[model samples]
Target: MGGDHTISYPILQAISGFRVVGAEECWHKSLTPLMKEVREQMGDGPVYISFDIDAIDPGFCPGTGTPEMGGLTPIQALEIVRGCRGLNIVGCDVVEVSPPYDFEGTTALQGAHLLFEMLCVLPGVQYSR
Candidate 1:
């Protein structure tokens, strides 16, 4: 949910069929509405969720190569993922977790939790842990 200005908008826009939401939009707006818009944009297509740990605030997840300051809080991150409840999700991945920079594995743990949250929303998936 966090895309610092580091991403090249021109290149992202050049992609044939994709939507890009910047961090500012995510931060300022309520996640529920934002996510509703995302769902609308995605339509009925099968979705693949990809979460980068760096999308979370460094205060909550500080183990990535590029830790951006103004990022999503752990709760906010989860809420956003949970908001995808009825989407047709096919797969997902959480990346950019570097244990070396993590304190007591907080980042890793959050990554796992986020993954679980994502799984709970996917079709036919039940969270066991």
Candidate 2:
């Protein structure tokens, strides 16, 4: 689960089009509404989530191959992943973590946590709530 931003091209080839909710959008909009757009486009179809590590600020995730100055917060990351709770998430991944760059392993840890969050949002995972 270490996808790079460039990986999107291949993924896009499989679909007709997509909506870009990059760092700029996440800064102003709620992921809930963003997820709604996804739901509207996907229409109960099987979905795959590919999260790139560099999407988060380098301060919080500097171990990635490309570190960006301003990015989503770890909390916002959870919001994004959690936003998929009701979708038919066929598969998901978090990529772009370069271990050598993050000596303390925080980036790796963020990747791991993102993976865990992805798992939690998959269909058929019953919650006690």
Candidate 3:
């Protein structure tokens, strides 16, 4: 057994060299350009996008504890997801959802629905074991 090593684990200690490579300003810009860069860098390989719902504002998605204001709207998120339409999707996981934070279940519903929307885009997705 390993202790939070590799892509399978979340701690990401060995990933010290890993950079938080995108600019916050860029996220507000058109996603197509960034997606193109990602595609070019990936070079005809598989890509997995984890569309975390918490990336949206807490006003609209109030279940997450760390909800950032002025985040992407659902439509914007969908557009970004659709932009990755032709890429080979290996897998993805949307996380950081604290359903308990949303007393009325609003955030949980949005998170689940977003996951469903992602599934709609990924037809051959392997259900996690």
Indicate which candidate wins on TM-score: 2
User: Candidate 3 on 1-129: residue-level lDDT in tens?
Assistant: 101113443333212221244336545566667666655665545566565666777778777767787787666666666665556556555676675787887767776766666676564654442
Query: What tens-digit string does per-residue lDDT give for candidate 1 at 1-129?
Result: 233234444434333356777777777556888788777877777777778899888998998878999998887798789878787776666878887888688998998888879879988876654
Cα-based lDDT at residue 64, candidate 2: 80
The full ranking of all candidates by TM-score, starting with the best, is: 2, 1, 3
- CA deviation > 4 Å runs, candidate 2: 3-17
Greater-lDDT candidate between 1 and 2? 2
Give the number of the best model, judged by lDDT.
2
Q: Which ten residues in a row have the lowest lDDT in candidate 3?
A: 10-19
Error of 1 at 19 (Å): 1.8
Q: What's the lDDT for residue 71 in model 2? A: 93
**Model 1, clash count?**
0
In the order shown, what is each candidate's alpha-carbon RMSD? Answer: 5.7, 3.0, 6.3
Candidate 2 overall lDDT versus native = 0.79
Cα shift from native, residue 95, model 1 (Å) = 0.2
Over 1-129, each residue of candidate 2 has an lDDT whose tens digit, in order, gives 665656564455445345776587688556777776777787776677888898899999999877898798888888888888887677777888998899898999999989988888889886543
- Whole-model lDDT, model 1: 0.77
